[model samples]
Target: MSRIGKMPIAIPAGVEVKVVGPKVSVKGPLGKMDWPLEEGLGAVVENGQLLVNRLSEDRNVRALHGLARAELSNIVLGVSKGYERSLEITGVGYKVALQGRTMSFNVGYINPVLFQIPAGIEVKVDKQTLINVKGFDKRLVGQVAANLRAIKPPDVYKQKGVRFMGEVLRKKEGKTGK
Candidate 1:
């Protein structure tokens, strides 16, 4: 039995989980998410906990068992309490501002980058340097943040650009005259 798959996902209050055929739907205060399970994977609720089971011994089936369970758990939790990722800008004059759902980034560029925020995700700026990303879907939230950060990822030499809060930037030393 898969260790992670064997574990039951505790259903928190106000979160609803429904299993129908090969699909599982999770709904909570924040939003709703659904995913289709593999051919041999099944889900059931018992003792107020969600259980994931695999119907085959195939390597591929076993591999997806745990992964699917974990993703479902995260979805439940995310919908209940939501998810967030914080980012910070580090530079002398680099900063960001949100104007009516458009992100204006001034990262040492000739013109500011105007990014249109996608639906279901909220971006907030503070003090001209801090960025807060909030959403229900963990994957989408993180991917969007990564894309934004990639616009001008923190540099090793001077550590300028947008970066996750507390993320470490390895500094590089300049070559010396020999």
Candidate 2:
């Protein structure tokens, strides 16, 4: 009865999907992703589309029905088009630069913070502030972006730090002038 679960995920060209028992593996040009089916949840490939069905009427099974389907669909999409997150660095003299496999951040520290970029993920810096994080796996892409953002969360007063593009910061007013 879940609206999302009722929808079928289409298999695009150059993408191969396999359903083995409770595990689903999708191989695409970008990469391969695998996930296990939840209890009472069943999925199959039919007519070039992935169909998700619930084998039981339990509430928990029903709840996971749609979520599992959506997550699998996301994986398909990720392998096809990939995922990307943009972050902006704001502050005086605050910047980021990439050196081969490592990223250097100049965020108010005497020494730049160095972070090694993970495999399958690409990090690009522009104008020393705008950062673009990209990868085929949505989960990994998002996690890397979050880790980069957490390195220097935005300040309330100056709003100076790393933040996702389009993210709003609640700026605090400066002290009243005497």
lDDT scores in order: 0.91, 0.93
Instruction: Please provide, for model 1 over 8-125, each residue's C-alpha lDDT reduced to its tens digit, 9 standing for 90 to 100.
Output: 9999999889999999999899999998999999999878789999988999999999999899888888899889999999899998888898999999999999888899898889
lDDT of 2: 0.93
Q: List the residue pairs that clash in candidate 1.
A: none
Q: Which stretches of candidate 2 lie over 4 Å from their true place?
A: none
| Model 2, span 32-107: residue lDDT tens | 9998998899889988999999999999999999899999999999998899999999999999999998999999
The list of candidate 1 runs beyond 4 A from truth reads: none
Lowest-scoring 10 consecutive residues by lDDT in candidate 1? 168-177
